[model samples]
Target: MIKQGLLVRAAVPACVLTGGAVAGGVSPIAWATGLVFGLALVLLTGWGLQRTGRGEFGPADWITFARATLVGCAAELIADGGHPHAWLVGLIAVALLLDGVDGQVARRTGTSSEFGARFDMEVDAFLILLMCVQVAETAGLWVLAIGLMRYAFVAASWAMPWLTAPLYPSMARKTVAAVQGVVLVVAVAGILPVLWTVAAVVLALASLVWSFGRDVVWLARTRVPAARPSAIVAITRRRAAPHHGPTWPAHNQAA
Candidate 1:
């Protein structure tokens, strides 16, 4: 949760700095001035925000928050717009280092929450999109498609309600998603050109496809049958449980 707050706050300033640097034409003097200012803001504000409040704040929260702020800055730096190459790469590496640590902080501190999970997830997503946009400028428009792949699945959930059902998380999948950003970042940094970038994009897309396919199959098989429960299971029931929850449950039951 602290990490999420850190990223959400950092994103705004990162975007602003990126724009300012680009608009100001990437002068060495301007870059140095902006770099110092950005670093100061990220450290002071991010650290302060993470350490705020008497009850919610803790060492772990501060640590994770610190990690996220550093990484988020790196992500913004590498994300096109004439950000310095060494600083951009350095920040990204720092972000990845903190990524592993933040969750440990949350777990050790016992401060993990849905808020934190969602916050981290969105931060990661936005970072991917940012990297995709920067990479696409060089790789090809098809590379941009990778950025929207997650959104495509998210939107499809509206049409196929069952698609929204959660599946048990896997570390392998998480690893794939995490590395996807790194691949694109490196690809755009010209460590690898269009050829390698395309391959990375393809593999990333395939990973998402596999994940969705498994979940869809699970939903199809495990979804409750559209009938009353067996007589034995129904013996102690007050009423049949709704097939869905809230919005879907109310509507499906009414229908």
Candidate 2:
């Protein structure tokens, strides 16, 4: 089952690369990069499935895999440096549109799992990062922050373990994240005036900052310190103690 699932997943990248070659005359560099990205994505995903003890890809995972393929194509386009704006924008737009679909499918199908959720999130993050790269060419390098913030927060968690706590779901956070992709895609499409594109990206970044800050503060407030070894031992001992209280009431005893 796993083998078949992986083969199916592998085909996505193959099709994407072939389509790019025929449609736009993919440069050697772009073709090579796309192949590497596709191979790495397949290998890593296979490793993850093995590590997680999953036998086959779930329905939602397939959706996320498709989205990831689109990102890979976008990366190839970025590498080629002569991609049509319409093609790039179309790929990203479809990917973004399918973003919410995977979650809904997972929920309805009862296949939701940590791996699936993480896979979905990683795809979203990478897409945003790629879009940021595209937008930065015109919007200024400050645009990269919108993509790098999540990774920065993740790195901070290694030093401050409290930041690793699971965050409560907030619609505001989801909204902020969704906005980043939409805004970046718009900026990439170059439909808006330069000033307006800059303004929209600025607003997106601001919202992202606010969302991350709010979560960090909440984490700090609710942070619980890890128990010391001695304290843990004491707790174990107390719980291990046997009850020795009398079973009879005082009146019955007197009688």
Candidate 3:
């Protein structure tokens, strides 16, 4: 399964390089860079996935990474002017859909790991960042919200380190992240409005807020109860007798 996955990743760069070479117009630099980038991506992911599998490979991680890379590579091509020549929209859309699946796979397959989680997250973040950069070139700087949202969250973590914990996946948050890609792809493809760009930014921010809140709540509630207080401590806090008579009366000798 891992080998097959690596093969799939390699195909993208191979195709890009072969096509770029044949075109003979775009800089060989771009094609070479794409190849190197793709190679590095595959190597890094391949190693991570392998180590992850040492614990166990979840079907969801495989599917999620596959879908992410497929959509990601397609998005890159479309954003770079390989548009109209391929089903870039559908490609990107599929990637967005898969965003929700890998975690499911990981959970179901019992293959979830910290390494896998971070690995998958970084890939997703980079792909969105790539899309945002491409869109911003023409859509203006605001379009950058799509990509910068992750970085902004990372920045927030520096201030409040608590932001990093229990970053569990949420459907609403996933939807918001996916929208950033869809809006950028469609907008760049000339199908969406410039004003809609603002909506993307809004959703991205909202997701960050929701994620932070959810984490805080989860952390607050998930604490393991400490062992029942020692019997001695419990007894010390208890009164020896009910207050049938007022102790203050004795001190004052009023009665």
TM-score ranking, best first: 2, 1, 3
Q: Write the per-residue lDDT of candidate 3 for residues 104-143, one digit (tens) a residue.
A: 7788777777666776788678767766666666667766
Model 2 lDDT tens row, 94-172:
9999998999999999999878988999999989999899899887899999999999999999999977766554677
User: For each candidate, what is the lDDT?
Assistant: 0.58, 0.81, 0.58
Show the colliding residue pairs in model 2. none
> Model 2, which residues run further than 4 Å from truth?
21-24, 224-255
List, residue by residue over 61-110, the lDDT tens digit for candidate 1: 45545554554454445432565556665655665566657668778878
**Against the true structure, what is each candidate's TM-score?**
0.60, 0.84, 0.60
Residue 151's C-alpha lDDT in candidate 3? 82
